[model samples]
Target: MEAESRTFADAEVNRSLTPEDKIRFLRDMYRIRRFEQTALKAYNAGKMGGFLHLYTGQEAVAVATLSLLGPHDHIVTAYRDHGHALAVGMGMNECMAEFFGKATGCSKGKGGSMHLFAVEKRYWGGHGIVAGQTPLGLGIAYALKYKGIPGCCLCFLGDGAVNQGVYHESLNLASLFSLPVIYIIENNGYSMGTSLARSSAFRQLLAQRAEGYNICWDQASGENIYEVRAKTQAAMERAREESRPTVLEIATYRYYGHSVADANARKYRTPEEIEHYKTYHDPLLLWQKRLVDEGLLTGEQAEAIDLGARAEADAAMKFADESPFPTEADICADVYSEVDEPAGDAPRGTHFFN
Candidate 1:
C-alpha cells in the first residue's frame, strides 16, 4: 500500500472542529489528566504499589485514537496504560482497585497498574515488557484476518520501542501478511532519560521507516486531539478496508518523569521547559481554549468538567482504600493453571508450588 501524504494547515483547520465534538474531546482529555493526578497522589500516599507510569501530557493521543476505534476493534499498549484503559471504557473504580491490588481490578489484581486486561471488551492488556506487545498485536490482527473478522488492532508503543528489533520485525511481518493493524508510536521526545536525537541515529522520523516496509504511514501532532483523531480514523479505515498496516507517529510530551519514582525530573529537563509545555502545549488546555473560543463551552462549563473529573477520581480512591488486599492463598491459585507433582520425596503440605 502506498503511503498517502496530507498536512493540516494550522490557520485553515484550526476552526474546523464542531462544538459538540470539541466538548467531548475536552472531556476525554480532562478525564485522563484527573485520573493521572489521582494515581500520583495514591502512589505517594503508599496506597498504590508497583510500577506507576503517569500519562499526564499524552492524554490527547490516547483519547483521540481510542475515539476512532469501534467496539469490534482491539487495543494493546505499553506500561503507561492507565489512560489507554480508561479510554477503552474501563471503569475508574476498577482501575483504581487494580492499582491498590484489589480483586475488583480489571486483571482481578493479578496485573497491577501496568497489566490491565479487558478481554470481553477486546482491550487486550497493558504489557510491561518494552516492545513486547508488538508481536502480540500482529498475532491479534492475524487472528482477526484468519477468522475473517472485519476489525483492526490498534497497537500503541513509545518512541523507545522503535529502536528494538521487535518493532522492525513486526512491521515487516505485518506488511507481508497484509494484517489490519495500526502501529501508533507515541514519540514524547525521550526514551526514559535518553532523548530521541541521542538514542536514534536516524534523527527521529518514524513514518519514514514505515515507508521502507512498503506500508502506509503518517505523523500527527499528539498535542492536538483533532489531528490525532482525524489521522487515526483515516488510518484505521484504510487498514480495515485494504487489509494492510499503517504507522502513526504522534509527537507528544510526558509531563512527569518515566514513572512517579522520578520526583526530581529537573536534573534532565529544565523547569522552564516543563512550564512551557504545561502552560502552552498542554493538550487539555489547547482543547479547552478551542471550545471556549467556539462558544461550545464557557469557562465555567470547562471548569465544571475538571471539578467533576476530580470528584470521580477522589471517589475511586476512597473505594480503593476500603477494598481488601488479596490473601496469601489467592496468590497460589493464579500462578498455575493446574497443580504440579511435588518434588521427589517431598510432602504435600510442606512445599507448595508458587
Candidate 2:
C-alpha cells in the first residue's frame, strides 16, 4: 500500500516536540527573515557586495535540517547559505562582515557571499559552482569513515544540482560504501529562472531518483519546521548508527529571484506566483501562526520576537558597515599556500610576494 500523506496538521498533532523547541524554531525563522530583509536593503544601498541570494521563504528547511548535527558532524551547501551558516551557530556580525568584504568575515573577505567558510564550526564552506560540493561532501564522508569517526556529513544542494553527474556519482559511492552522509536537495521549483519541470525530463518525485543508487528516500515540506526536524532526526539516527546515506528532498519556494540582481522575479515566473507564496505559504509566518494557535506563544510574544530579530538585523548591518575592508598586505599573504604553486609568489616570505 502507498504511504499516507503528511500535512501540516498531521505534523502538528503527531510530531513530538517540546515548547522550548517550538520557541527556538519560531525565533530562528524570524531571525532569518529579518536578516535576509536587512541584507537586501544593504545590497540596494551598496553596503554589502557580491551576488546576494536571499533565503526569504525557505528558512525552515535550513534551520530544522542542520539542527540535527552535533559539533563533530560536518555541513556543506550551495550559494544560498547565509541561513544555513546562521543555523549552524555562526554569529551575525561575522556573517555580515563577510558580505561586507571585511577581513574579519568568516572567509576573511576572500570568499564573499557565494563562498563562505567556517571550518571551526564544521560547516565546511558553501560552493559557488552547481553540484560542486557533491564530490567534496563524498570526500569528507570517506575521510570520516577512513578515520573511524562516528560523525555524519550533511550535504545540501539545490534542485538544479540534482541533475549533475557529480550528485549521482556521489550517491552511488556514498551508498555503495555506506558512508554516513545525508544529502538534502532543496527544491525551490526554479533552477535560476527555469522551473524544475522545464529542466528535467522526468516528472516523478525527486526522492525516487535515490532508488537507482540504493539510497533511502525521504521527503517533507521545507516550510514545516516540525516535520523537517522530525524527519531529519530519523535520517541522522540511521546515518550515525547504521552508516547509511539518505536523500531528502524538501519541497520549497523562494520568494525572490535567483539572486538579488533579479528584480521581483519577473524574468521567468509570474509575479502572481510570488505574491501567492507570500500570502499563503510563507514559512516563517506559518510557523509563527501555528505557535500562537497552539498556545505555545502569544501573538504579543511572537511580535516581540519579530522586533528583537529586526533589532539584531539592524545591528548586523551596522557591524558590516563599520568593519574595515581587507588590506592589500592581507590579500597578498594568503594568495598561495606554497611558493611553487602556479598562482604567483611572495616578495620576501616563502608564500607571499612581499
Candidate 2 per-residue lDDT, tens place, 30-65, comes to: 888898898888989988766998888999998888
Worst 10-residue lDDT window for candidate 1 reads 1-10
RMSD, one per candidate, in order: 5.1, 3.8
Encode model 1's per-residue lDDT on 1-354: one tens digit a residue.
112212431323334646676687788778878977998898999987767988999998988888777866898999999989888888888999999999777777889999988887788989999899999999999998999888999999999999899989999999999999999999998888888887786635876799889989998888767678778877888878988999999999998898877655667778898899999888889878866775678899999999999998999888888888788777765543334444565444533634
Worst 10 residues of 2 by lDDT: 1-10
Q: Residue 244 error for model 1, in Å?
A: 0.6
User: What is the Å distance of residue 198 in model 2 from its true position?
Assistant: 0.8
Candidate achieving the largest TM-score = 2
For the record, the alpha-carbon RMSD of candidate 2 to the native fold, in angstroms, is: 3.8
